[model samples]
Target: MNGSPASLDAAAMTNASVEVVRDVVYGHGLVHRARPGGPVPRALKLDLYLPARHAHTAPRPALIMAFGGAFHRGSKENDAFEAEGGNTSVADYCLRFARRGYVACAIDYRLVTEDPEPGTTPVVSAPERIPTSRTDVVRRIMNLPPATPDMLWRGIEAASDDMAEAVRFVRSRAAEWHVDPARIALGGFSAGARTALNVAFGEKVPVAAVVALSGFMDRADLQRHLSGFDGGPAVLLVSAENDLDYIAEATPGLVAQLRAAGLHCELLDVPGAGHFYQADAVAVHDAHGATTVERAMAGFLRRTLGG
Candidate 1:
């Protein structure tokens, strides 16, 4: 308050501090605290990584990150849901944004498993079925409950719906959170990536950009919640060249759709990487797997949402 006009102007131009803090809570109308110890769902909360008070005096662009678990198991810590440092985004991958002075949030979404009477087996084809499709690939490897074409799709729809509300939730607290209501971006890995795509193309929300890491969605499914509006937001898609899921389907179609709709979109192929780059390919590729994608993400956010 007692600085020269020149000094104050400089301070305003550049964020003066890098201090980081976190706030977590359920979104509006999403708070459902279960009775003391009843299988409460994983806390429907997001951890925010914020900069210093001075830096946030003006609204800052925000990013909401969803983790990928093939639509059944990822979390805010999707980068390492089962390994150490898997609970909070502040400790793992999402924390990288704090240095850049952007408020980043890692969110967890509802994951529902198909239910069937125990010991009552699922109907199997006359011949032992060879699994196919991205869902089938993940289902076999993860040993998850038997899923039908219908169930897996329902899962994606549910996750994307939550993402739409999460954007609204962040804007609802724009003043308190110091986040620019108009500059929010969405991105995620694996299944989370699919949800991000759905959030931008599948429905209407005030989104500036989208970053998808190894994710995809069907046009018809995305059409289920379409809200006619202005031009769509920019999008970036990243997938492993070896990812059985999209090397042939999804990404190609998605890129075509974005272009046909007159929207800007980019796709980066991660060579030698699998579906889960952080978990499976980082070490083998000497960090190119994750670093390249993160760099692309930073560049995309900067170009589309600005600081």
Candidate 2:
């Protein structure tokens, strides 16, 4: 979706009263053309948030957060989840980091279905066809897919390129945002997480660290190559017991590979949580109650981005 202020302002205001308790911060959203690609034929844009009271130094640590929608659909806006007190959007998380003294940017990347070829039937049909019991309609939307291995690989590459461009774009305009260029890290969920891992683990781009919530690294060979790079970004992988996706099973192996390659990696498997921890209302209740994901993410940022 468009990251226009009008589009996000209401959500932000609706969530304003929802206090995260740990930190208080302010964030702003800007739409910048990071690259020119896809059928849209326009500059791909992303939203950035800065910590409260942050002053631009020569270099400031930053975090690039990406959301997941199975590589076919997703927006920075998708992180909005309703809780008892108020709502928590991905923007809120970005603001939290900004409050803690880090520049956080949630990005919008091109997805597979952005402009599907005319008359070509999609590999995965409508969400209603999936028999999942989750009531979240968004999850149903994520069920549609480019199911083939080739399509999956292509999506991964496109997203990786988009992410690389975003990193470069942020650093390129660091002066304008009062951000430090050297300490940028990356975070994403599911497919977005996959993109983060692929890019961070790939040779094409270099980041300080990567935080993945239920994401796996593609192209094992490329991951091995990343392992050999000295001081490559540290990685944090978070998953839950109820995760039915390949990520839960795959992360351990990826962690092993990264460690074998001499890269620092940390994994957190939340007990009884599912594919998307926020998928179920009760799970959301439990996750929020424990502050499991947020706590881990905060700790990770403090170490990796110096927030």
Candidate 3:
């Protein structure tokens, strides 16, 4: 036996071990789009947070988290601010989902490039000065870039398109991403929720389920793109009752349509909260019960994607 210990080899140690992927695997998978004279040929960068191997192994269910900023801008990270607050970063969801036995991705999508010209109309945020119209809420959706109807519409479409690409990218790398293609799902908050719904309906892709936080889809929009995909997937709808407009105007009819169309739809409503339950969860959790949103969402995922 040698008296001296064997010399350590730094290269050998580095080569033998897999790179420790803590936090997330970022800017890896890509989705490409070719637009005529488009400013950017490549769009969207994605991040994946993997859970413990034993907890969630190969062919795991995957969910895509989209951020909301009135469709203009957002980070792919969960820590990306949720104006409504309760967000612990979409990455948190990915990590937690991975822990609970799933693979999750936070993907980027293109936003409306055109911001309204400054001073064309003075921006007003004061409670008294604010418009009491539907456009007002839409305007507030984005922190930057004064949005108009057309810009917002394009923003929604662009974001939805890129998200679809993300989904397709996941499916294309199903083996690499360790995802079960059949169980893919989409979820988002507010504007992001709208994007999620748009992806669910606008594209012809097959997803096992959807988790929409404070959002809904128009039946007409769904029908418009019905030819692209076949079959209806279950949906988990979460909302705060304090948002009267959503409760009185949208949710009831949306739920009815979901049931009428034979889609499994579950609605979780917080009786005393406002428009941004997620934000409230982050900033004023006790009053809003923001964490509950994740609990119910996880439960739904466990049931829907557990298989």
Could you tell me how far off, in angstroms, the CA of residue 8 lies in candidate 2 after the best superposition? 9.7
Write down the lDDT of every candidate, Cα atoms only.
0.60, 0.59, 0.59
Q: TM-score for each prediction?
A: 0.72, 0.70, 0.71
User: CA shift at 294, candidate 1, in angstroms?
Assistant: 1.6
Alpha-carbon lDDT of model 2: 0.59
Q: Write model 3 residue lDDT over 83-165, tens digit each, in one string.
A: 44544556556556656666677776665554222111111112232222433554566444354555445455556666776
Per-residue error for 188 in candidate 2, Å, reads 0.6
Among these predictions, the greatest lDDT belongs to 1
Candidate 2 Cα outliers beyond 4 Å, as residue runs? 1-40, 55-59, 80-89, 115-146, 222-224, 278-291
| Per-residue lDDT value at 168 in model 2 | 80
Residue 252 in model 1: shift from native, Å?
2.4
lDDT string, candidate 2, 1-307, tens digits: 1234443444344444321111111222222233345333434556666443344244568888777766666577565433222223455567666666677777776665443222221222222332222223443556653254444444455666677778887777677667767688888877777778767766347787888877765434445455447668888877777664556657678878777777777777666656656422231212223446677777766666674
lDDT of 1 by residue, 1-307 (tens): 1122343223223644443333355542221233443333343456555565634268888888888766666556434543322222223445566557676777766654522111111111111221236556557778865676555544555576667767877788777768887888887876677778767765566688887777666554443433354588888877676675443366777777677767878777766655545422332122234446567677778888887
